[model samples]
Target: MKYLKPWRSDGGGLLHLTILLSLAGLRLDLDLDLCLLLPPPTLLRDELLLGCDPTSPAYALSPYPAPGGWGRADQLHPKGREADPAAPPEGQLLREVRALGVPFIPRTRVDAWLVHRVAAGDADGAHGLLGAAAASSAGGVGAGVDGGSQAAPGGGGDPRASPSSPLAARQEEKAPAEQTARVPDADGRASEENEVLRERHEAVDHSSQHEENEQRVSAQEEKSLQQKNEDENKTADKPDWEAEKTTESRNERHLNGTDTSFSMEDLFQLLSSSQPENSVEGISLGDIPALPGSSNDGMNSSAHYNVNFSQAISHDVNLHEAMLLCPDNTFRRDPVVRTSQPQEPFLQLNSHTTNAEQSLPVANLTAFLPFVDNQMRNLTSEDFLHDLNINIFDEINLMSLATGDLDAMEVSQLFQEPDSDSGLSLNSSHNSTSITKSNTSHSICEEGATGYSSDPESLPHHNLEGAVGGNYPAPMGHRSDSGFCGDLAFQHVFHNHTYHLEPRALESNSESFSWPEKPEKMSRYLSDTERNLSRDERRAKALRIPFSVDEIVRMPVDSFNSMLSRHYLTDLQVSLIRDIRRRGKNKVAAQNCRRRKMDIILNLEEDVCNLQAKKETLKRERAQCNKAINIMKQKLHHLYHDVFSRLRDDEGRPVNPNQYALQYSHDGSVLIVPKELVTSGHKKENRKRKREGIEDGFH
Candidate 1:
């Protein structure tokens, strides 16, 4: 029996060729659309049983030309040898042959050479059924032959003597004559002859000349085909550079007409040119067209149109000027004149018109027309100055009173003006006296004169006598009378309360007016810091707490206790103080807890977001792992089928999976046993273990 030489020196001999052919057959079977259209298990089982069974009819007759003859005449009786009349049956002979371990010819090499010859002879028909069946069954038949060969010595018998050798050609020429001379046996046992005779013939014809010639021809054909395919692939892969360049040039030409760059000056010029000719800068009041409702019959229509047009033109001009002057480009229009009294109708159609009709003003006309240039020119500087001073004085008085409380010193400082030698200073003293008297009378009436004595006996014989009589005394200084008037005015402004002025207004006035250098005596008249206090603070102040309201509420427990010990406070005072402290702490704690709760909620939201992202990532990973597992399972299934299909019994028959099952041992060796036997053996083992456990329990 010839043993399979898997590690052959000459390019891995017949065993390697068998494996390659088996792999090629598997690839072709897998590629068939029939596998997708049919159930996978059923299709795979049919293909494996049909293709891998060496005894199948498809593989019974070797595709290669036998050296002896087509019917094995020479193998049965070599050189006119007589046949035995009492020869055993074909099955018995096969069993006997296998038992004896006789070597056979290397049919794998012969089949491969036959396929090559057929392919060379008729290239167009090379893919026919005969070629396909031989390729598919090559591995299984080779494995059987290898097993038989291993049972006998010199299995392959020769290194050379391939099918393409001249010796094989000579045998082919004599095959026809031998076939004619040979007679068929009635029992059909001729085909059952031992393959030992063919092996002997192959061993005798081990020559190398014809094999070398065939190898050289086949190598030249393969090299030329490969080189041609590579050249074709290179041409197909190359890009058309010339066409691409032409396309790019065409696109460039299309874009050449448009300019993409522009300066800021160009944008400004374009915007200016886009403006209308009748813009506000070019149009005047005279240019405005009269409305269709205006009449030429009376001066009233003309006057009304003039008023409306002037108002419109003035509004447009003001907006245009503001846009050009202001950095923010915002327009601040003048306030419109509003009147409480009713006016005559623009067109008094009749003298008997009702008062309601006469009172209705024109829809689009201004309530008062703008003053003419002549009227404005008639206004003197003194009149303007006087009006300006009165407005300033009113604003100061209002601002001082807005806080409803003002200290005596703050009020005095507010009205004090800077020393200047202008003629306006002379009249300031006389005007200041009247202003102080009026403001003092108003403050006394409104605020109940708590800081001053209204009695004539307490009044001082001075210009500010009515203003700060008992509350504040006028400061004595070398400053002008304007300074003294300012001091008197401020005393009346603040009265006996604390007042806060706008910081901006205070700063502007401070630059012009200087405060009295000696204001120490004024401090006694100013109210205590308890002014504008909350009810609790006022009550605490009235009770005369030694510590301030802030210290009482915010001090630590030990400090508060020490403060109480030092003060000798009543029980009522102590209880009230403790209540104030507790309320303040609770308010602060509530604010902190609200902030902390919001932070915790935000952190939990962030955590939820992160966990959701992680869940998505895990879902994606699980999907990928499942896909990989399915792919691996498919490959493992194919590998299992391939291995099982290669298994054979001692009689050289393919093992049937229905009767026998393949199992793995603990040592990792594969063992084939009948299905029923495996199940019975497992059952017996389980029963024995159970019985042993019971006996151990009893013991």
Candidate 2:
């Protein structure tokens, strides 16, 4: 009777399936050694056991306590079983234990795990191993329970009697034998009651069996899922591995490029064979096929196959041999002469010849003089030697002048016209050709001279000077061992000429020439400003800044703006504001002003809050005082009523005010505020406020 409701009613069929699904999804991958217990087994077990009343002593000894009756009164202890406020039902406890044990029930666990892996497509043996471990453990515990159950049915039956005592006989005599009797003549009422009890027990047992079945089915489903996972993993790995291998093979093919049967070693031999045996250093020739439309007759083919040995020997060939493998003339064949003169037959300065051109340095004129000689020697062979001699002397003067040789003037004067026929040949049919030749020759002569822009009249009059100054004339009043070259050359020319004149040649022969003093100065046609600038440059001093108020006033506004902007004072508005404000109030005072503004806004909000709080506090105080006053009034009224009732002659009536004075405590202190003072304070505060307002208007 103490069992109240059957245990099976507390559990449900869906419980097992829900637990199994949760177990499968849970992140806690329980190790075999940790066992099938919840994280905090004590807490969980106790919490889950709620309402089971395990703490009750009688219930603890026997879950279904002996039927409460008068006969068992002597056996019952004075302190009955204390019911536990928290205790789970028998079915829930059994299910929880099984949920924990499911992973350890060896045989079933191994089977489930293997099947799960297969269903889940996980080929790895990990799942099966873990499942087997759990299954074996649970199976052992379950087997132990089964063995004990077989050893003793109903636990020796009848929980009411002490099993070992001979007093049991007496207890049996008192036991309700009619409860077990199967008589057919029993009343329908009794029989129906029995049937009802039997049905309830059978229904509970059936529900428990259903729960067990659900757990078994859930385990089977999990096994299938695990197995499916294994299979899928195995299948996925196969294509990935094969794809990796295929990619590697394709990469190998791309790098080798071995479509043809020819090997790299054979190709190397053929390439080497195409080049000549005597090929120079740094030369490499590739195997070149024959050109299209080329004559490949025996003689021509022989020429194509052969190397130009003489041409190769004449120069150090730095070019690759692959270049020579092409058709004839595809590669250049000119000799690169690094140390010799040009082949134009011009006399060289380094040569040991007394000839004028041979004695002169060729460095300056060599670049320009080659073409004239080439053309002159090639045309009109009859005067070639004589013309060559005359041209050689002319080239010497040009070369000497080009190189700034000390003997340039002498050479130039020597080669100067013995007659008017001294200049370039004018009778040539090719004016353009002659002009080109003349320009080149003259250019060389001009570059070689001391001054490229020298005046012809000033040449003979020029005196010795340091060559560092670019001016061509030598300074006067100085004597050298050989005299200045220009002066010497001038004297030689003068003495050799047919015309003789006095020492002061210009004065005696005014018809021939005249000269002016201050010859070194530049032409007088120079402007005054230009002359003044040159004279000022000749002196060394810093120039003073030319300042004028008008110039400053005329300065562009853009220039002034640019200067202002660089200094970050560009905005006119900013400047105007700065000018007006000049110095702001002290920092502290400014800060205080800003603070006051913020405080006013914030204080406005705070004032409303404080006022509300004050109102609430006042309301609360008023309510408390009112409640106290009402309570006191009620007490006073009762006191007055009691006093009046005691003092009256039999009729109920009001009491004397002196006899029933109001009494109360406020804030833990006695207060005695008379009604008159309270009323007067209120009236005075109102009158004072009204008078102050009237006085402010009068002021």
Query: What are the runs in model 1 whose C-alpha is more than 4 Å off?
Result: 1-550, 565-576, 657-659, 675-699
After TM-score superposition, the amount by which residue 506's alpha carbon in candidate 2 deviates from its true location, in angstroms, is: 66
List candidate 2 stretches off by more than 4 Å.
1-595, 648-699
Which tens-of-lDDT digit does each residue in 1-699 have in candidate 1?
011111111111122222221121111111011111111121222211112234321122221112211111111111222122333433444344334322211122222222232223432222221222222122112212222122111222122112332323433465466556545354332322212222211211111112232233223322332233332333224343333233233222321313332211222232235332211111111111121112431111223223332233222222112111111112121111001000100011111111222111111011111111111122212222122122222233233231112232232222222221110121233233322433243332121211122111111111122121111111111222222222222222211111122334333322222112123532332234422444344334322344666787789889998977665443324544665577667777888999999999999999999999999999999999999999999998887778779999999898887788777899999999999999998899899999999999999
Q: Among these predicted structures, which one has the highest lDDT?
A: 1
As for model 1, its CA RMSD to the true structure in angstroms is 65.1
Candidate lDDT values, in order: 0.29, 0.25
TM for candidate 1 is 0.22
Per-model TM-score versus the true fold: 0.22, 0.13
For 229-314, candidate 2 gives per-residue lDDT tens digits of 34233333445434333323322232233433232222223323443221211111001111111243211222222333222211
In model 1, state the lDDT of residue 80: 25
lDDT at 442, model 1: 33
